[model samples]
Target: MKINAFADVSLRALLVLSSAPAGELLTTQNIADAVGTPYHHVSKAIVRLRELGLIDVERGRKGGSRLSQAGHKATVGQLLRELDTRSDPAECHSSHGDCPLIIECGLRGALARAREAFYRELDGVVVSSLPSFRQMAPVFQTIGLRPGM
Candidate 1:
């Protein structure tokens, strides 16, 4: 299944923050530049993350965003679940009006099981275990993103 850009950006942002010293604040634009995502999109994701209690935002001139206390402990699956509301991979009608094979098909159930397995695997990966920009320098370079950008 394909995860959306929002999930990618949010995860990248969290990973970037994880690499920094605890309490180090990163501005929305800084995260956008680092992750090579649109600034506005990062800003919106930041707000959503903040509301989810994964991040904390400070106000004013010296203010920026920092991860919440649980951020490090927050599993990638948790983050994805919070950020990805439409987690279902199967397309089925609630009233059984759209899908003719709702009663006979096992594909939806199989896909759901696969999706759950995928998330279970992702749950084993901690945010702190994510590769840093320095570690992924070659990849960043290949994609034209300068290290530490």
Candidate 2:
């Protein structure tokens, strides 16, 4: 199942924040650049993540975000569930009209089950453990942070 762009950006931003050293925070723009996403997209992702209590944001000229303690323990599945707001993977209704097969579509249930299965598979994976610091050297470097410095 394909995730939405917001979910993708949220995951990327979280991964970037997880790679930072303790006490090191990254601004929305920095995260956007690191993830190769537009600043506005990353900004929205940051706001959602902050609302979910996944990242802590400090407000000020020097303000930035860092992975929160909850973020470290959050599972990929949990984060995705929070980020992906769609109840149905396939939109049955559109400006034109409802899908012709909306009444008897078996694809909907199948897709929903598949999406749940996908989330189950990732439930064991902690967000912070997605990549090791050594493995994230390049990602950190992309954000102008030297790993292990």
Candidate 3:
């Protein structure tokens, strides 16, 4: 299954915020730079996260974005579900009745079960359990977050 870039960015954003100091507000540009995504895309993802009550945005010079609550209680599954995006690996046309062999296709069932297992694994992971950004400094640098930014 291929998850969208939005899911990647959302996860990164949450993980970054989880490592940041409590109540520290990070700008959209900051997040964009950290996630190696466009500013507008990060902004849109932030809006979605806000709508889902996963984040709170503060507007102004001293304002930015922060997690609505601690990361300990936030599961990766919650973020993925709130994104409402799909990561389906197979193009089973059973929904549109386009595939004549869908009824007998073992591939479809296997893919579906695999997808469920993928989400189940994700569900078991909590944001707080992830290594801190400081610990992943090399990764952040590789993703374009300049040192000390």
Among residues 3 or more apart in sequence or in different chains, the pairs in candidate 3 whose N, CA or C atoms overlap within 3 Å are none
C-alpha TM-score for every candidate: 0.79, 0.91, 0.76
lDDT of 2 by residue, 1-149 (tens): 78888998999888888878779878899899888999999999999999999999998999999999999898989888887888778887778988999998999999889999999998999988776766778877777786542
Model 2 error, position 63 (Å): 0.9
- Give every collision pair in model 1: none
Question: Cα lDDT for residue 51, model 2?
Answer: 94
lDDT tens per residue, model 1, 23-142? 667777777776778999888889888888888899888888877877777888777767766634666765556677778688988988887787787887887567666665654454
lDDT of 3 by residue, 80-109 (tens): 766645444466544666667657788877
Clashes of 2: 0
Q: Evaluate residue 67 in candidate 3 and report its C-alpha lDDT on the 0 to 100 scale.
A: 78
- For residue 105, model 2's alpha carbon misses the true position, in angstroms, by 3.0
Runs in model 1 with CA error above 4 Å? 93-97, 136-149
Which pairs of residues clash in candidate 2, taking residues 3 or more apart in a chain or in different chains?
none
